[model samples]
Target: MHEKLTIDIETTGLSNQDEILQLSVLDTMTDEVLFNSFLKPSHIKAWDEATKTHHITPEMVVNAPTINQIRDAVQKLLDKASLIVGYNHLNFDNRFLTKAGFRLPERQYDVMLKYSEYIKEPNKYPEGFNKTPYKWFKLVDCATNLGYDWESRPHDSASDARATSWCYRKLAEIN
Candidate 1:
């Protein structure tokens, strides 16, 4: 059976050394949350900048499970998923997941890239240099554009994963 999974991860920062602060995965077809949890960072002592964007503080994940503890289960979900979907996941979330020792499936869908092309939002770049690229949309913006109402905070991994799945479905309808 082919399974589509939507995943999202929050990290300390956009660096190879940044630890994953949270991870969420959902069944795209059924919208079932397969996994959702805050992860305690292994090395980082602070994440003020990331906290500002995601609102996940150190204290929030103090007693959370470490990545190693949940690696096997998450990897199993990844292995079962035929296509993993996320917003800007190709550029961001996957990198963090790979760095944290999770193996991702080869089949993946980047909702941000596809939705940007669909909306025809131009990227901020000089004109007449080359072909213009589409501006990636945030998960919240994509969800809002598709009339998806938030049930919880936006930056939370579970919330982001849900939004990504919803956006993917909405975009699929118009595609």
Candidate 2:
């Protein structure tokens, strides 16, 4: 079987232009943590809201290795995966990786998208016919709702990565 990996990243902001502060990748099939690191930012300032969400401060990353310093290793891990998965990765993590100069694997999966599709509710229309509606879900909220025991705090890269894996497994079982 082809290798499967799950990845998660914590950043300084929400936009693609934001700097990545932490990243985690896990080999899902093997249950091995392939890469986990906190990157020191060189170009962007850490936003207060982002820090509150991820609990990563500028001081915490001050002595950490920059993205450039670990790009090679991260790329290698990504290259080895036949499928790279993440929570909201297609819309968020992938863009940041590309902006930071990392080549992502071709086969990418977004657990958030899958979960949204699985639990989608029909939109209520007061004046017209109803249609399928897509709703955004938080990783922690999804995992807990699916009955998975998610112990790590939300927004931490490693914790999010693990939660993504749990979500993937649960999704697979249902399908």
Candidate 3:
């Protein structure tokens, strides 16, 4: 069966130096959770803002495995997936994975980009006026727009992964 993996990550910060606090991967075709875990941080410190967003505390990851320890298993899941997808993965999640030394597959899809194209509003202008308009939607916003309700807390990697998978399915139906 052709399988696509939808992933979501909670991180310590936005930069490359940041650590991935949590990782979630789900099989889109089967709705199966392939892998999910809170990674023990080795270098970066989690910021308050990040903690506020993902709610991943240091105590939560105190007994979790580090990325280095789980890299092989994570790679196995990735290798099995025909395509790896996420809401804003290309810009965010992939960077953290790369920084953590995980080699990713080239077949990647960004649900946010697909949703953007699916919901884009054409600019309207008065006579003799010209402008290009754009609309950007966050994962939660997109999920809400598509009538996706979270089964668990938002920002938790597994919950976010499930939500993203739902969004991807919805977007696929429309497109």
Best by lDDT: 1
Per-residue lDDT over 1-175 for candidate 2, one digit per residue giving the tens place of the 0 to 100 score: 3389998999999876689999898986555788899999888865788988889998899899999999998888877779998998888888889998998889988998889889884445534521336666788889999997868688889888988988998899999
lDDT for 152 in candidate 1 is 87
lDDT scores of the candidates, listed in order:
0.88, 0.85, 0.82
Q: Report the Cα lDDT for residue 72, model 2.
A: 95
Tens digits of per-residue lDDT for model 1 on 1-29? Answer: 43999999999998898999999999987
Better of 2 and 3 by TM-score: 2
- TM-score per prediction, in order, is 0.93, 0.90, 0.89
Q: Compared with the true structure, what per-residue lDDT tens digits does model 3 show for residues 53-169?
A: 888888899899999999999888887778887988887788888888887888988888778778876535423222225354689999999999777888988888888889988
Best by TM-score: 1
Superposing every Cα of model 2 onto the true structure, what RMSD results? 3.6
Error of 1 at 114 (Å): 0.5
TM-score of 1: 0.93
